[model samples]
Every structure is written in C-alpha cells, then in structure tokens.
Target chain A: MATIRDLARRCGVSVATVSRVFNNPDAVTRETREAVLRAAALLGYTPSAPARTLATKRSRMVGLAWDTGHRGPGWRHPFLQELLVGLKTALSERGYHLLMLATGEDADGHLRAVRRHSLDGVVFIDDGTADPALTRLAESGVPCVSLDRPVTGRRATYVTSDNAGGAGAAVRHLYERGRRRIATIAGPGRTHPGAERLAGYRAALAALGLPLRDEYVVEGDFYLGGGHAAMRRLLALDECPDAVFAAGDEMAVGAVRAALEAGLDVPGDVAVAGFDDIEPASLVRPALTTVAQDRAGFGAAVAAALISMIDDPDAAAPPPTVLPVRLVVRETSGPPRAG
Target chain B: MATIRDLARRCGVSVATVSRVFNNPDAVTRETREAVLRAAALLGYTPSAPARTLATKRSRMVGLAWDTGHRGPGWRHPFLQELLVGLKTALSERGYHLLMLATGEDADGHLRAVRRHSLDGVVFIDDGTADPALTRLAESGVPCVSLDRPVTGRRATYVTSDNAGGAGAAVRHLYERGRRRIATIAGPGRTHPGAERLAGYRAALAALGLPLRDEYVVEGDFYLGGGHAAMRRLLALDECPDAVFAAGDEMAVGAVRAALEAGLDVPGDVAVAGFDDIEPASLVRPALTTVAQDRAGFGAAVAAALISMIDDPDAAAPPPTVLPVRLVVRETSGPPRAG
Candidate 1:
C-alpha cells in the first residue's frame, strides 16, 4: 500500500531522488540511495524485480526459450520436469527465477521479446528444431546457454550428455555379449545427439572390425512409432541382426514392442539397447537396457554457465559442457542364455 | 543500442522529461509522450520490462511455486512434464511467461519472493506440502490458482481432477468384474485428492451395501514404494481383497509389482487399479486399469483461470474447477473368466 512518495517524504528527499534510488541508483549520491532504500524497507514497500532491474541492470531472471509445441502432443522431452527441478533448485540458491520465453514461428519475434524483457541471459532447450535462428542465436553475442545443442558464441555455451560415449558403450556392451550382427535405430541426422550417436555406433563397429552394412542403419525420428517401423524393417532383412541399439529410449521401447509382435524373444532372439534411461525403460516388459543421461545435471550445468556468463562479463563464456553418461544394463540386452 | 538521452536529444526534450515518459508516462502531456515514444521507436530504444512496469504497473509475468525437492530423489510428480507443456503452450498464446518461485523451508520466504516479483498472478503446483503459507496464499488477496489442492480466496481458485467420481468409477468397475472384496491403497490423508478419493471409495462401498472393513484400507504416500508396502500389508491380511485401487499410477504400478513378487496373478488372483494415466500406466505389465486424469487439461484450465484473474481485477475469482476423469479398463482389472 505504500507509495514512492511515502519513502521520499520519510527520507526528506525529492521524489525524483527516490526514483533515482531504484531507477538509476548511481545517478544519486550513495547516502541518498541508502537512505531511500532503508526508508522504503521500513515502510514495507515491495520493490518489483523490474524496478530492481532499472538500477542494477540485472533482472535476476533467466529466460528459458523452448520450442516444444512443435513436437506435438505425443512427443515429450524426456525428464523435462526433473530438469526444471534441478535448474530451479540451483538458481533458487542464488535468488533467481526462470522466465519461460515464448518461441512462436517467428524467430525474430522471439528475440524481440527477449530484448523487451531485458533478460540477464537466455537458455535455449534444443527440441530438434533445425531453425537457423537458434544456430545464429549462439553467435549473437548474447549471454546464453543451449541444452543438448553444440552451438557456442562469445557469450554462449552448451550443456549436453556424452552422446557419443554412451552410444559407443552400448554397442561395445552388445558386442561383449556375443552379438556379432549389430544394427541401429538412430535419431534424425540433424540433431547434435542424433548425429554424434550415429557416429559413435559406427565407430564402435569399426573398432570391432565389423563390416558396415547400410541395411543395418535405419533412421528414426526419435519417437516410438519411428522406432517400431525401423525395427520391423530390421527384422525383415535377409540376415537379421543379432542385436539392435536405439538412439533414444522411446524408440527402444517401440522396437521392443515391434519385436514382440513379431514373436521374437528379446535378448534371446535379438538383443536390444537404447539411450536415455527414462522411467519406462525399467517399467516396460524386458526392462530396457539403455544409457542414462543426467537430465537434472544438464539443468544445473546450464544454470551455472548462464550465471557465470552474467556475473562475470570479463570472463570467457563457459565452455560447452558434456555431462557424463553410463549404460544401465537391464533385462532386454543381457548375454546369450546358453552355448 | 539507443539510450533515453539519444531519444530525448532527438525530440529536443530534457533528459528528465524522457525519464518521465518511461517512469511516469501519465505525468507527461499527450503530445510530449507521443513525440517521445515516436522518437524511441525510430531510434530503436529497447525499454526493459521493468521500465514498462514503472509506467503501467503491470508486469506480464506469472509465478509458479512448487515444492518438489522435499519429495526426495525417489518421488516424481507423474505427468508433470505434460502438465507443464500444456500450461506453457496456453500461456504462450497470451504472451505470459512462467517464473519458478522458490519455496524453501521458510514459508514466509516464498511470500517475500512473490511480493518482490510483482507477479501478475501465480499458479501453485501442489506437492503435498500442507504449509499454512499455501492456504494463506489463497486468501492473501493475490491473484492465484492452485493445482490439485482445493483452497479459495478473494482472488484465488483451484484446478483439480474429479477424485471422488474417478474413485467411484474405479471401484464400480472392479465390482462389476465379480470382485466381492475390494480394498484401496490410499494416498496421504492431508492432500485434497487423497481425502476425496478415500471418501469416494467409502461411498461406493456403502452404496453397494458391502461392509467397509477398516482392515482393507491401507494409507500410503503418493509414491511407488508406499503402494508396494501397502500391497504387502494387504497380502499379509488373513483375508485378502480380490481387487485393489491405488490412488495414483506410480503406486498402482508398485502394487502390481508387489502382487507379482508375491506370486499373485494380476487380474486373476488379485486385480489392480490406479489413478493418473501416466506414461507407464499402459507400458507396465498387465497394462494397469486406472483413472485417467486430464493432466494437460488441468494446465490449460489453470492458465485460463489465472489469466482471467490477472486481467479482470473487479470480477469474482473463478470458482474451483474439478476436471472430469474417465476409467480406462486395461488388462489389470477386466472381468474374470469361467471356472
């Protein structure tokens, strides 16, 4: 209920001086600024975050730009809530909040809103959008961090899982289990994770001296249906693969469903592996053997990098960070039962 | 890149006059304001949201208060990501952003943050914390909407599923399947959904003229482990119920796992049902027969109500919303076969 006038009157200063204390604190004398703030505090005047932004030039709020709507209702970002929890927990400790930015079709419109908000920094969550604007955003010199995307800039960084390592580990695990004819259901080639994971799968096969068979490599859109279709094709090949690895868990589950529908025994007839150990991986029949990415860790790392970019402008932007990943061996991809 | 000074100089106005245009636009004459704004547009001056707040006293930001961390690592809010996606998509249409408000140990701390942000409105995600602060928040004259918790204030409304109706449907479904003795794995008594569901179960049993045996009702937290423990206790009883309904999907899955571990055939020896048609509901073995709450619908409804509150200062707060739910009869609780 208190107004600026009340604080100014109590401090015996002009209203402009009081405004300056919040709008342009540096414009007024330090003593004047302190007197006004101290009086405002006593009067229980709530200073809006924007008001604080006027003086400090920092909103203490981070912008989260995500274009997830394009994914449709069927697709969900794996572990999104967990990632948000992690990001919020870390940011809360430093007195910051997250602002979910709207990313409509117009990329420029998104940037315009970002500028209007005077956001301290922005974190872009990669949702497999090949939008050139996002790629250019990393080069825009704005303090930013990308999740699961590898673009970087003067003040932009990225946080992602070790896709290549995880994929390689999955392939090697299958090989160790005596799976000689290995195949893959990969994600779209456009996404960073997709491309890197595919590369890892190939590299692992190359290291093991397995011939690269084009028929074994199937491209999926990283959803259940795509995985299922790819698996159907794999099963139809003249020489079916002894094992299959999917780039994501959703697809892996689909692959399992497809195999089961085809009357094949999982891990016995054809072993299967997947990336991203989402909840269903363990709950699904056969208990998916997949790689587990640190979804929460990605959030914490993004927050840290963005904060670092904002707090110390003098320092270089945090380098692209790759959190570790490990394979979770479950029922679906164990070794052969007998000789 | 343009400053207020540049715009002021361009318009041949004093720097104070330009400041007034942003900080106190009403104080300036219409002609002077028009000239200043036109010049600002021409010069590409980016006014911070805080500056706009100073002029209009409206910050188009909403607060999201959730206390999920306390639930510990093992606990996860089922369908959170879907709920958030729905909320964000709807909010995006209105150019509103979500601000994650930190609700740490100190209840007052949450309120302080709320006040500091000058949020247009708030949407509180209920995470089973019965802090009086949340109850009081509804009555604090701040425009707010609660999810899954029923509390109303002058400017507060809540969005929740039809717990009672859903529970009754589940019970009746089990009964029609020839289950004479029915039991329930209930959620915490403190939560609104939990209490309402328990009441619904009792009402259904009473309506059926079946004796409400206290031994059949087992209380569990809204988590997987709780349901598992509750199921274990139920199995140990001298006379086990033929069918069990868990208040949540996670718990229902746990109950199924417990029944299987105890060598009981689901839908044969011991039927199971659950609420919340989360992703794992259909994926888990026996495909849980559960009550499907519209998680995304809850988000959309919450957004609509909160926005209505924020936009209309004089109208009455939207009344509490109880979204409809439907019974999904899957493999878990189908009718029994011939002897």
Candidate 2:
C-alpha cells in the first residue's frame, strides 16, 4: 500500500500541495494538479475520509434509529417505506451515510453502535413517546430529529404529520356521511402518535354531541390480528355502531375481514375508515376510505430538520414542524343505510 | 475538548500508559488505571477512535449493501425481516457496526460510500442475482456474503434457504392431503428464488402423476392485489384446482378473500397454502399452511460466512450453506372432497 506522502514525493510536490490538489484543485496550478492526480492513480492512493472528517469536524454520517419491533417483520407498514426513500434521497445530496440503529431489545448494543460509528446526526422514526434513544442522543451532543413521534421534555427537533388533525378529519367525514354511532379501533396508547389519535377521536365524538360508549372503542395493537379481535368485540355489542374508524391500515383490513365474515356488506351494513392509506388500502375490495399521511413529505421534513440542526447546532429549533393530512374518501365510507 | 496527551502529562504518565487505561485497562495496574480514568474524566478527555482505527487497520464497521428499490423501505417480506433480526443479533457479538449502503439507482454511489466508509466486510441481502454490488464487493477485496441468492461467476461466500426443497415440501403436503388439481400463484420468473419455487411446484406435479394445466399457473408480483386478480382468473375456469399454493403469504391472503367472495370455504371448499410463514399467516382467520424458512438461522449463516471471510481472506470458502425448511400445516390445507 502506498502512502499519500509517497505520492507527494513521487509527484515532486510538498504534502500540503498534494492535499490542496485533492481537497481544492482550484488552489493548485493545472500542471501540479495533473501530476498529483497521475501519481495518486498510479499508486492507487485513496484519501482517508475519516481523518479528513476529524480535521473538518464533520463526520458525514447520520444515524437512522427505528423501532424494529413496533410491527412484526414481513408486514412492514408500506407508509414507512415511502418515508425512507425520501429520507435517503435527501441525505445522499449532502454526502452523508445512514446507519441503522434499532431501538429496544438490547439497547446497549444500539448505543455502542452509535458511539463506534461517530455519526454526525440521528433521525429517529416510529418510536414510542418514551424512547431512551432520545436521552442518549441528547447526551451525545449529536443533532437529532424524531419523525412521527415528538421527542418529549427535550430540545430535540421533530417532524411529524398532524395525527390529531387527521383523526378529527376522519371522524368528521364519518359524521358527514350520516354515521351517528361511530366507533374507533384505537392503536396502542403508549405511543405518542397513537395517544394523540385517540384524543382526536374522543374530541370529535364530544363535538358531535354523541355520548361515547365504552363498547364502541376497543384496544387494537394496530395489526390485522388486533383489528380482527377488536372488530369482533364491537360487533358482539347489543347495538353495534354503524361505522368504524381504525387507527392503522392493517387494523382496518382486519375490520374488513370481520365484517365480511358476518355477512355484512361494506358501506351498507357497516362502513370502515383507516389511517396511513397503505398500498393494500386501494387494492382491497370496495377500497378503503381513510386518511392519507404524506409519507414522503414527512420523511423529507425530518431529513431537512436534521440537516438544519447539523448546519446550526445553536440555532433555535423552530417548534417541531407539523405536516398536514387530508381525508381520502373511497368506497368504504358513505351515508348509513336504513336498518 | 482536552487532548489525551494533555491529560497524560498532568497524570505524570506516558501517552501509551493512558491509552492502556482506556483501551486495555486489564494491562494496567488497577490503581494506576483508576487514577488515569479519574484524571481523564475530570478533564473531559475522549479518545479519538478513528485515529486509533487507522493505526490498527480495523474500523470494526461491516457494510450492508442492498439494491435500491428492493428492500430500501417497503420491506413487507417476512423472511427478510426475520433474517435482518438474525443478522443484527449475530454481528453485535463481534463488535462490528452495520452500515447500510444502497447501490444507488446506479452503482457509482454505492462504490463511493463503500470506499469512503472503509468497511471491513459486506452482506448483500435480497438483491438481484446479477447486482453490481457483488462485483464491487469482490473487486474491493472485501469479504462479502450474499443472503438468499447465489453469487454466480464469483467465488464469494453465499448463504440461502433451500427454496426448491421448501417448495417441494409444500407440494408434497398438498398431495398428501389428497388435493390433485393443485394450482400455484408463482412469483416473477426472472428471480432465482421464485423460479426455483416454480420448478419445485412442477416437479411435485410430475411426481404425483397429475396433469399440469397451464391455466392453473398464473404469474403474480408476489403481492395481495396480484394474488386476488390471479385467483379471480382461476375461479373463472370451468374447473378450478382443489387447492392453491401461493409463493408468498400476502398473495395467499388475497386468495383467501377471493375464495370467500366466491362463497367458498378455505380448506372446506378450496385449500389455500402459502410460503414464508410470516407472522400474518396465523393472524389470518383460518391461518396459513405453508413452508417456513429458518430465517434466523439464515441470517446467522450469512453473518458467520462474512466474518469467516474477513478472518481468513485466503482460505477456501465452505460450500454455500442452505438452511432447512419445514412444512407448517395450518388450517389452510385439508383433504379435498368431491368438488
């Protein structure tokens, strides 16, 4: 292996000259730059990036911390995939690397990975409200941003869709469609997004002057299985609700299956709406009426927030930027039919 | 921000002695190590890991390269998810960091990232069979391992599950259950795993002395929508197969919906079995009877292969290890009555 100094000596130039040719060619004469380039190619000399980063005080590496177990593998929420694409595309523009740091279940391992990689920043996605990665990131003095969940009690920046507003819009849509007995399959309450969505559901019901019934709301884990169980419980009620709003798409699909099994027609016997409008939402029979979170936009916002923090560590972070959401009315939600 | 050399002079010891306290504490006397540690902590001195790694010629960072547009974000495949978990757990024990490198829309970005990061080894997961990442990894003299795909024309180490064998087991399960007219929703024919699975399906039909009808086989994109459309076409036939075997669980879920829509009962009227027994398999109403890949073992195998290559670059690689598969006969498949 040839050293940079060897190339410098071979090119008949000072080491500083070679560094100038590589880092900023405009600073060196054309002839000197050509000589340095020839020597570098001949000796297969690759500049030490980490060393340069150390000198420049910029590692050019970003941490991608995620909740690996939020939903089981194989049935990845397709909504997140779009967000990832947007995030990766933006990060590449600035020449930064993404390192996967899965949270929970061996957190020490994640912390160790972070310290070893020397990441310049971290972007956390799909984590619960009380994730420890936030505190660890804070202590490390690395610029960090959270997506989908606001980092609580911390000065960390965040980018998330308007979950509460989306849920409210969904409820309003159901009410406008003439649904009085509206029920919701709320996702796990521990997660900030989930809790906010549930709050929105309650607020909408209260505004509509409808008495909230315990039997109408069932705890759903945000997967198809949980939705199926919740839907079954809702249907077993003495007077079942005319409409259902599921927090996640998977749960909504489960609700579809439960409705079909009971010989009830979608939008006639019961209407269903979901959030995150995953790929399967449109493909399923009759399609799904749901709220569409701008997944790619959310990812872009988070990436932009992280880059801003990296650019100005001491800059006052604009209050966690919240993206907007809209209701996508499909075939599922409609006016209630006569009993 | 204090330098280690400054802390060493204050502690009245050589720089090497202070390094031993941090890097190899066991080599130093406990009292001396404690003194050095206390002084360093008080001075807020931190060791520069990149400088140490450059001197030692080991970054302790493993590269994970995946073809862009594959598993970049919408990772819905259960098998891949399980494999990720397995790989993460196995490599954490070896003190190696996994850096995700997407072989950009083109291959240049991937090469740049790999060259910049100075990765120790790389594992390519679920990429195309002729992906450029394989060629780059081989040329870079980096020990590389291909997961779930064979690296053709390259002597690089590879690990995969027995796809053909898994498929054969599924067919045999269906045959034993007395389903003669067996239809299959095969994946795209260009991929290795999908092709092998299709071949296995054919081989079983030949061995069972059953006539293989061309109409019974439809190419699906391995998604639920494709499955539903394919199932609809099969249902339109003058005579449909008594059982259907889908290459993936999502497709099988679609088949379940199609069957129900046609007023057919799963296993009672039309048996449905899927491969890659993902979490959703059991969650679906009747549950899926399919072939289960030892995903964790597969992940471990890839990690172990990559590590061994790193340890002995010149040593001959063991033959490609194929993890075993099992037939999980759930409620989806049962004996076929006169249809």
Candidate 3:
C-alpha cells in the first residue's frame, strides 16, 4: 500500500528524490538513499510491474507462440521439451520470463494472442503451416524469430536445425551400409522441415545413383501412429526396402515397433534410422540410429536472435541461422546382411 | 502512433467519446461506434497492452511456477509435458496465457519472479521442498494453487493425484500376485508425494501382514537415473525382492532396464510397478504396470482452482481436491510364476 509519496513523506524527502533513489540509487546521496531504503523496507513497498512497464516500455517478457495444429498433445515431443528448457534457461539469464501463447486450432488465434500481450519479443514454433499472422507480426515491427521453420515471404530471423543436411547424412549412413533399397517416412510436405527433409532424401538418392521409387516414400505426421501406419504400408510392398529412414524420432520408434510386430529382425532383416535423436531414441530397443540436432543450442540461438531484435529493432535482420546436425549410429542401423 | 485525440478530431467527436468506443463500446451509440471504428482503422490506431494493464489491473496472465531445486532438466519429465498440454488447452479456452517461471537453484527465486510479474494468479508445482516463499505468496493473497505438492502451513488450494492410494493399490496388486518380498523405490522424502507414497507402501505391507524391511526402501530423485541406481542397489541386496514398486514411471522404466540388464525376466524374476503412467509407460518394453493418474484432469483441476481464486479471492478455500488414480495392469506386473 506504500507509494513513492508515502516513502518520501516518511523519509522527509521529495517524491522525485524517493523515486530517484529506487530507480537510480547512484544519482542520490548515500544518506538519502539509505533513508529512503529504510522507509521502503519498513513500509513493505515494492515497485509495481505495470507502472515500471509503462515508464520503460519494456515488459521483460518474451512470447513463445506454439501452434500444434490439429494434432493434439504436441508438447509430448521431447524435442520441444528440450527446446523449452534451453529457451527458459537462456531467457532467465537475461531476466526475461517465457509467456506461452498456445495458438489453438485456429492460426489467427496466435496473432491475436501476440497482439494482446506486452511482450518484448516473440519466438514462434512453426507447425508446418503458412500463417499470414506471422507476416503481419513481422510487418508490425515487433522483434520476431521463428524456430524450426522459416517464415516464408517474410524477413524475420529464423533459427532451425540443419534438417536437409541431417536427412542427407542419415541417407549417406544407410547407403554406406550397403542398403541400396532405401525408403523414407517423410513428414508432411507443407511444413518447411518436412519439405527440406524430403528434398534431402531425394537429393541423397540421386547423388548415390540409386533409383528413386515412388512407392518407397510415404508421408507421416511426424508422430508415432503415423509412422507405424506408414511402415505397415511399406511392408505390404511387393519388394520391401532394406532400410527405412524416418524424419522424426517418434515416427522412427513407431516404425521400429511395426517392424518388430511383423516378426522382422531390427538391423538384421531391415535397418531403421530416424532424425531428431529425442530421449526415446536411445531408450527404445535397438537404440535408434538417427540424426541428432542440438535442441538446446537451437533454443538458445532462437532466444538470442529474438533478444537482439528486441534490443535493436532497426538492426539489419540477422541471416537465417541453421545449427548443424550429426549422425548418431546405434543398434538400429547396421551392415547389410548376407543374402 | 495515433492517439485518442487524433481519432476524436477525425471522427468529429470528443476525446471521451473516442475513449468510450475503445474501453466500453456499449456506452456509445452504434453510429458513433461505427464512425470511431472506421476512423481508427484508417488511422492505424491500436490500444497498447501496457496502457490497458495500467487502466485495468487484470493482466490476463497466469504464472506456472516450476521449482526444479538443484536438479537441472527436471522439466523434461513426460508427466509435466502432459500437464502443460492440459493446462494450456484449458487456459486458452478462458482467454488466459501461461507464463513459465523457472525457479532456479534458489528457493526464493520463485517468489521474486512471481512478484515481479503482474500475474492474475499462479499455479505452483511443488518440487518437494519446504519453500517459505510459497507461504509468503499465499499470505500476500495472490490466489495461489499448489499442484502435485501441498504448501504446508498455508491455506492455499491444492490439487494432487492420490499418491498414497495409488501406491497402496500397486502394492496390493503385487501382493495378490503372490509376491512376498516387495521393495519400493521411493521419491525424495522431503516432498509431499514422496512422503505420502512411502506411507502408503508401509500401510499396504502392514495390512497384507508382510514385514516392512528398511533395506527394501531406497530414495530416488523421481528420475530414470535415480531409479536405475536404486534398482541396482536392490539387486545387490542379500535378499533381492520379488517385486519392485517405483514412486514414478521414469524410475520404473529405469528399474526394468536395470533388471533386464541383470538378466532377470520381468514378471518371472522381479515384477516392476510404477506410479504416474506417462506416455513412456506403454511405449517401453515389457509395458510397465503402474498407477495411471488422469494427467489432463489434474491440469484442468489446477487451472480451475487458480482461475476461481483469481475471479473471487474472498471465496472460502476449496477443500483440497484429490483426483483418483487407477492401477493399469500391464506386462511388467503379471501373475507370479509357478514354482
């Protein structure tokens, strides 16, 4: 209940002196500052966030806009959890808190939520959809950064894993194992990551002088069930592929489960590889051999990008930063079996 | 950049009339509202969030206070992910956003972060520590709701799973399966869930007329590593238990891994049961049998409690609501093998 006036009256100083002592103590004499601090401590006076925000025009908050699309419980992905931890740690170091803006079923909901919040900047998780709201936000000059997906047709800074490069490495790893009949469970093509991964798969096959079979590719929703169904479809093919590479760890786990259920040996009968080495990748039987992205580094990069933009809005837009990915070979992918 | 005066001048109305159109449209006539809206749209005027918050103390933001204590990456737990999904869904429906406040190593950091933000209310995830900060927040009447852990000596609303009951059911189920030597991997004893679960384990052993052995109980940090270490210790004991019950599913997974690594058949040698059936419960090999708590329901209950308190702080504290948990019989805890 104590205001600047109350502190000033109690300390026998002007209101401006009390405010200066709290806001900029170095500008006031040591005795005056001590007197004001003593009165404030006694009165249990704490500066209000709203008043400070109004004065500084800085909320010291960043918005994390996540759109799960129609797929529910998207937070179940361990990759997102890792990213969240990284972002939280990085932001906290700068005295900023993360405000989650869950852009539910509707894409426009994200824009509306972002507009309503007094966020210093925003980091968006691309749901593989083209959202005009992002363009609008970028145009509004709010410091914005997209994670895992680039904002198409917009100049916003983007932080993403080397999706295409990771996918290519996975394919190359499989190829070196003498698995010529390779297949892929590509993610939905509408999203940037999915499209890049699929492109990588095709490019790898073409570079290796291997024939690209249309039946070898199936689309998945980057989830366990979708991967399972896609693998089953591949198994039903007249000539099953010798190796399967999934674009995500969840799907890779599902594919492995499907292969096991069909009475097939994991690396012996058919090699399985996945991307994004999530927690389950190592826990599952045969321990997935896939491409591992630096999730924490990716998160930190995105946060740094957003914070920089927030600090200097007029600075030239930073080039889209793509963190590198590496291959993690485990029991899932092995040398080709003797015919 | 356009102010209310600019809009009023363009619309040929007083500044108060223009302000009324934005703050309370119902107070203005339809013609006046239409004229002001059309002029405002043409002038590119948008109400600032800080100004709105200053005018109305309600920030429409809820804080999620997560204290991980000294353990890093504690937020990566699947249970927390599921709860976050549910909370986001429920809060989004009510036009509220979730702010994540990661309370670092310091116990008092949570209180400082919560106090710094203009949150309408906060949902605290008790990390099993006796935090005086929570008590102070509750005393300050910030409409606090503690989830999964109760704030002792405080009248704050609490929503948690039936830890004791769930543990009892898991133990009794093991007993009915004809397993006598049962051990438990308990959580940290300083927390509520851990204490309650330990009590339940003891109560069940007493009711079943089985002697409670002190060496059979090992404390874990509610993580996979802890569970794995504790299980290894149990395996090294002079009389290894026939069945093991872990206070959390992650620990159970670790226990199962430890047993399998030790060449022990799951149900035949050492049955494993866990509490808090997370996504990994069914995904892991030998599908863990554990107590399944309604994670989404728990999230909804916590959100509802916090929102209610925010809406009506004067309302009598709702009695501590405990959601039920059920035993999910799976491959890990099958019937005892015939001698």
Candidate 3 lDDT over A1-339, as tens digits, reads 567788888889998898898779999999999988988878867676667777776877888876655344453444776788788888888878798887654545555555455578778775656567766776566777887666642237788888998998999999899899999999999878888999999999999999999999999988899999999999999999989999988899899899999999888888999998877687778889999999879778987887787777578568889999999999999876678
CAPRI accuracy category, model 2: acceptable
Which has the greatest TM-score?
A: 1
Model 3: iRMSD? 2.7
All DockQ scores: 0.60, 0.32, 0.49
- Weakest 10 consecutive residues of candidate 2 chain A by summed lDDT: A70-79
Query: Docking category for candidate 3?
Result: medium
The numbered model that scores best in DockQ is 1
Better of 1 and 3 by TM-score: 1
Per-candidate TM-scores read: 0.88, 0.85, 0.87
Scored by Cα lDDT, where does model 2 land? 0.76
True contacts kept of each: 0.81, 0.26, 0.52
DockQ of 3: 0.49
| lDDT agreement with native, every candidate | 0.84, 0.76, 0.82
